[model samples]
Target chain A: MANKIFLVIQREYLARVKKRSFLLATLITPLIFPTILGLFLWVGMSDTVGENRKVIEVVDENNSFFLESNELYSFSYSELGQEDAKLLVQEGLRFGFLYIPKLDIQNPKGIVFYSEETPPISMITNLEASLQSKMESLRLQASGIDPLLLSAFKTNVDIQSIIVSEAGGERISNSVVNYAIGFLAGILIYTFIFVYGNQVMQGVIEEKSSRIIEILVSSLKPFQLMMGKIIGIGAVGLTQFLIWILLIGLVSSLVMGYFGMKMPQQQMLEMSAQQGLFPADGNPEIVEILQMIQGLDFVQITLTFLIYFVGGYLLYGAFFAAIGAAVDSPSDAQQFMFPVTIPLLVAYMGLFIFVLDDPNSNVSFWLSIIPFTSPVAMMGRVSFGVPWHHLALSISLLVAGFLSTAWLAGKIYRIGILVHGSKVNYKVLWKWLKQN
Target chain B: MEILSIRSLNKSYGSHVALKDFDLSVSKGKIFGLLGPNGAGKTTLIRIVNQIIDKDSGEIYINGQALKMDHVRNIGYLPEERGLYKGMKVKEQLLYFAQIKGLRKQDAKQKITNWLEKLNLSQWKDKKIQDLSKGMAQKVQFIATVIHRPDLLILDEPFSGFDPVNAEIIKNEILELRNQGVTIVLSTHRMESVELLCDEIAMINRSKKILDGTIQTIKEEAKTNVFRVKMIPDSMEYVPMGEELRRQDGMLEFKLELKDQKPNELLGMLMSKGEILGFEEIVPSIEEIFIQKINESHGE
Candidate 1:
């Protein structure tokens, strides 16, 4: 039986790996991320359309406000009436106009932006920030303080999060890095389960539809065949993922080197500093980001990811296989698929709502402990630092969940693989499950 | 020696019984015919022997040993609804099956080459199964079933998709395998082939075996004590005391009631009046016996 299972796995793996479609998908999927990123960067860097700068006319009734202009837009202060500014905007003389009415210093109101198209949020935010700063300086002057001196005294505070371990010394923690790691790992497991679990189900449906399953079951038990398929396809997914990581890393680095571009880690550090997470004195050090990444317990998180990936796939893959066996065609599988997909969908939603928002929250804790949601939700929390005991409990429950689902699926698979030419429903499946 | 034996095996699916107290045995080197109409328990019995489905109750023995997973290694099954991996190359598919049946890789490769050559399929070795014609694919399915040289071969409707020439080839191979001491359980609706190949037969209907015995014995049991005689024209003055059923091609076919009289007594009376050109008792064909038995059971 063991040898037979090995043969089955070998056949499944080899058959898929040798297909042109598999090769194309595996090779192209990883490149998709870098490709989209490159496209966005190219579009941003290249300004082919030589259009006039967006002009905005500012009408300050009190004549106490001034706004600056950037490359994409030009602001012109005017003594023109509000009605005249609106008419100019209507005639396409300006992109829009900002009207500032005389306001109480403490409670300013009636500041409105009018545009032919809805202005971008960033534009509105920039305008609002400029106005608020000007108003603050004016208020400082009214209190008989030097506005320049007040600006000179302003200093940005940067908080460094550090974790002191019993054996290892203090290590800096970056919430941004932790969130990115958790989000990526959680999504990776979710994608793997969806992709390879479908492969297992499709393989079963193909064998059943082709009528090869009867011959297969003759020599090997149904459970062995099902497990062989699940494990085999899982290995294929792992192989694809590993290859994608290696090839994407190689190709992106080569391309970036050719373009004289900094690595993604350096770029992410710059982005973090630009987001005001670091002091604005100079460029943020790359070593700090690297240290924060190293401070994360990646070994633990990666190991847990692997465990949950396999456990989740086996649990869901069993249900997928059973659904595949129970239905006669791909079209017939949809009705059964909804219920099976519900748990996965819930886990995904819960990961975003509870785990990513606050990993230590009660909702996140419960979702991580539950076997169905834990594969995604737990990984989402792992990078945020989960309790050791909770992780162990989740892993144990997931294993038990996989085993029970496998047994149940084996029952349905044993009977359903042989059944044909009938509309199998939940009632029929229930009867099949009830049988020995 | 019985290579495969089943005793009082029973199986049911929900309220529908597929096999009930079914007993069968295929002796070594004999072709055992599992005859039945469509929807009879013949497939169910074969599936049990192949261990494809578990029997609800009963015992299955292979070579006098209780059946186990290892027993599957000795049995080859060609199912009624047969197919190969359509997208897989013929050689690779056959090798995969051979390996699954427990052959080592090198052994499977060698055997696959041999089977491909023997079946005149070497030219199509690299072709996907879907590329082959129906008859060619059926031949490949047969090779996959037998590539491991199993001791017991169970073929359900083995010739369903084959043309006559291909069917004949497979029929000859089955006989050759039987001659080499392989026990065969053949379940098919083609009774003519059963008459040609089967040594013993069992007919199943409605999940039960209604008739079973050696082919000759079953035929004998179904006989009506009828005889056909051909005599020289106009040589007899008085006819034998029997109902003259028909006269065709210079043969007088008659039905006899030998309640107390011996067959030789009637033969003596016929010989005195005419030259006995041909004389032989008539026995029913398997097809006739099958229908008659089924009708009798249905009547009861």
Candidate 2:
């Protein structure tokens, strides 16, 4: 039986990979995502060039330092008459004009901006941030406190999490690994359910609508045909997935090398600084990330993700194949799809709220051990440094889930593939599921 | 020896009986025709024999043994509806089906090559089924069905969608397979093909076999005993005496007055009145026989 199934798998995989659509999608889909991202970035960045006009003249009699940085729009200091600036605003020579009447010397508004069109949010934010920093310095000086002493009041609070295990030694910051595992698990499960479920539905619809099932059901069993199709299409999907992963890896490396060469080292450093993270110096978070990635515990997280990703995909794939056999049309399948997909959706919700909230919490432990949601939840927990015994239990549950779902799906698939013309309801599906 | 036999078969689509107490047998090497109108339970019976659909009650025997999984490998079925996957290339589709039918890759490839060459589909080997014309696709489907070389072949509406030339090509192929000692059961509405190819036949209607026999025997049995006679028109008055049907091409045709009529008396009367020019009997075509049988059966 295994050999026969493998033969079918080989045929399906080879046939689909050679298809124009599969080849196109494999080569094109990844490029499409990155291209779309780059396009949006380019559009946003282009709006900044050759388009700056708005300016506000600040007449600060108190010599208050204000508006810094020209990231959004360039600012130029001008000693001009208020009437002249007003005329310029009316004539559309300048976008707008602003004047600070006076600061209260105790409680000050400090700065104001004016614009015909509401000044871009980035520009307003930059101005407000610069003015606030300067005001804090002045306020410190007015209070007769040393500005350096005021800056020195910043307290460094750095936490180093540690995990000690009976089987394994000490670990640090397993939270990131656990969350990454969980996210990976959820993504794999979601992808399989959506992808294979529709394949089954489309396969059923194709056979039923074409009336080929009428003849096919005669020679072989309906169950046999359904199994063949699910296995066949699954093989096709797996082939495409493997190809896509390989292609994406290749493309990513090429892009990284090309962009790395093109970008100046200083600009790269500055960009990282702006995001509040920098490597080699200044920011400790980047150094921690690099360290964590190299740690022994990261190996465990990688291994767990690999196992759960495949297990979760196959588990959900079985249900998808079963649903496909049961429904007459894709639209009709949607009625049953909600209940079928609920577990995966609920798992995602569980990860977001309970598992990610407290990876070591009782809720995360239970959710991670449950077969239906374990693939994702367990991965999430792993990142948070879960115990070895829990990891074993989660893997076992995932395996059990795959086998049981495959059995159930095979049963339903056998009967449902031959049935057509009427809507398949819960009542009928239950009967099929129960039939010997 | 009989190649296939289906006895006391019964099937239903819900409350409506599609086949009831239907029995049929096809002998080895004979091209057997099954004639029936639409909704006459013909397709239902074929489906049961193929085991595509299960019968509510029946025993189907092949080669004097009970039907089993291996029986399918020995039987070739060309269904009424086209079953080729349109997305697959013609050669690839044939090979896939051939593989499913228990042919090895090498064997399937060899057979596919030969079949493609024979069918003049060599150039279209790599063409998708959807790209082929309906006739070409049908031919590809035929090749797939016959690729495994089953002893028993069942074809439903085998000539549907073919032009006269292609129909004749298929007809000859069907005959050639029969000549090679393959038993065939063909279900079709074209009575002309039945007349040309079928030596024996059984027709089903309304869940029952209404007629079954050799072509010669059934035609002989269904004869009306009508005759056409031509003389010097001395029979103008006697035509009424013999239930005169009509005159055609200067010949008088009539049905024998079966009440008290004597053939010798009628002949003597015709001889005495005028010289006998020509006389012959008229046999009904299969089309006429089918129509008459259906109408009479319904009326009864």
Candidate 3:
């Protein structure tokens, strides 16, 4: 049986590997993937990439409000009337005209800004924030507090989170870093399950529609055929991913080198920042991002990710194979696909609403524990630090889930592949399953 | 010794009975024809023998041993609904089938080259199955089935998609393989092939065997004990002992039942009536027997 299955796997792997599409996808994905990511990054981080900051002509009647200049906009306080400042904006001399009229400080009415284009809410919020703080200080001064001392007492508080291992090792941590890892790992598993799981389904359908299924089953046990196919297609997926990893790594390093980008030194600097060995840099986020990345438990994340990756693919792949065997064609597969797709959708949505928001939430814990949802949901929680016991429970359930699904799918596949009925339904599938 | 034996094997799907208490034994190195109308459980029986599906009850034995997973390697089955991977090359596909049936790679490669050459497909070995014609593809499927040189070959409608010339070629190939002592189970609706090739046959109707015997025994059992005679009449009014079935050029054909009369007695009576041009006992063909068996079962 083992040797027969190996032969089948060899055939499946060779058949797929020799396809033109497989070669094209394997070779081009690394290039297109980075290009797409770069496009998104260039579009998403427009501010940091240096677009011109708009200037706002400010007409402060009381000279009381002094707003800060930032990357998006700069404020120029001009001794001019509100109408003149508005005229300057209308003539395109300035991007905006901010009129801070002399009013009762308590009520603070008739404050407006004029611009040819509507300002973003974030810009308006920024202007409101600085003005609100200034008004608070003025009100405190009205209560006879010394303004200089009030300013001196206004120091912002920041809390740094440190994750301490039971053995007393400490590592600086950030929720954003956990969120990013969780998001990436979850999406990767989700796509992998869909991509390769569907490939298994398509393979079964191909064998059936081509009328080679009975010929195959006659030569080998249906379970062996199913298992061989799943493993074979999975090997293809793993091969493609390994190639992508190598090519992407090689390309990125070369490009980074070409641009004189230092990575190891950057990681070192991030490690030092984690130790607070250097003073805060010009932008605190630079130090914080690197430190959070450096403190990540990647070894744990990688091993767990791999387990879920294979476990999830196997678990879902069996059902896809069963569906393919039960149906006559891809169209017939639609009716049976929902039972598999819904749980994945739940896991995907639950990753954001429950796991990513608060990994310790009861919903996240249950989602990560349940076999159907764990492959995706657990990845979202693992990066956020799941308890070992919980992790163990989830992995065990996933294995059991795969075994049970394989058994069920094996039953369906053995019977379904030989019987080609145009009207195969749940009742027929249930009958097929219950026969043994 | 029996190359394959199935005893009291019963199988069902839900409330539908596909095979019930089916018993069969195929002698080694002989072609056993499994004849049945559509939906008569022939496929079910074949599938059970192949162990592609389980028997609800009963046992199958091959080479005096109880059937198991390993027995599949010794049995080559060509399903009625059969095909090869369209995208796969002929040689590669044959090798895959051969290896899956337990042939080593070196043996499989040598066998594949020989079979391709034998079928005049040597030049087409590198081409995909989809690129081959229907008859050529069927030939490729045939090679795939026998590439491992299995001890027991089961062919279900093996020549269905082939043209007459190709079918003759495949029939010759099957005969050649049988000459080499490979037991074969031949199943098909083609009675001519059954009559020509089967050493023993079992006719099934509505999931039950209605007739099982060697070709001669089956014909003997199915005989009506009626003689067909053609003669020139002494007189237009003179009638024979039997009813005239046809007449042409002053000669009349008659069917005479041999009821309570010896052959000499019947011939003596016919001789006095007219000159006998031709006289012979009517032996039924397998096609007639097949139709008769199915009709009788349907009547039941």
* Per-residue lDDT of candidate 1, residues A1-87 (tens digit): 687788788899999999999999988998888787777766655643335568999999878998877777789998999999999
Give, for candidate 1 chain B, the lowest lDDT window spanning 10 residues.
B232-241
TM, every model: 0.92, 0.78, 0.93
Preferred candidate (lDDT higher): 1 or 2? 1
Give the per-residue lDDT digits (tens) of candidate 3, residues B184-222: 998987898899999999988777778888888999999
| Candidate 2 wrong stretches, greater than 4 Å | A1-7, A32-154, A166-168, A174-181, A192-220, A258-283, A296-354, A360-382, A385-436, B223-241, B247-251, B257-300
Instruction: State the lDDT of candidate 2 residue by residue for B135-169, as single tens digits.
Output: 88778878888898889999999888777777887
Measured over all alpha carbons after superposition, the RMSD of each candidate to the real structure, in angstroms, is 3.6, 6.0, 2.9
At residue B77, candidate 2 shows an lDDT of: 89
How well does model 3 score by local distance difference test? 0.88
Task: In candidate 3, list every pair of residues with a backbone clash.
Answer: none
In model 1, state the lDDT of residue B105: 87
lDDT tens digits, residues A1-436, model 3?
A: 6988888788879899999999999999898866665566556567555466788998888888898888778889989887888899999889998888897888999989899999889888988988898998889898899889977888998788888878788788788888988998899899999999999999999999999999888888899999999999988998998898898877765655655554645656655767666445535765676666777788999999999999999999999999999998898899999989999999999999999999999999999999999999999998777779999999999999999999999999988898776589999889888887
Sort every candidate by DockQ, greatest first. 3, 1, 2
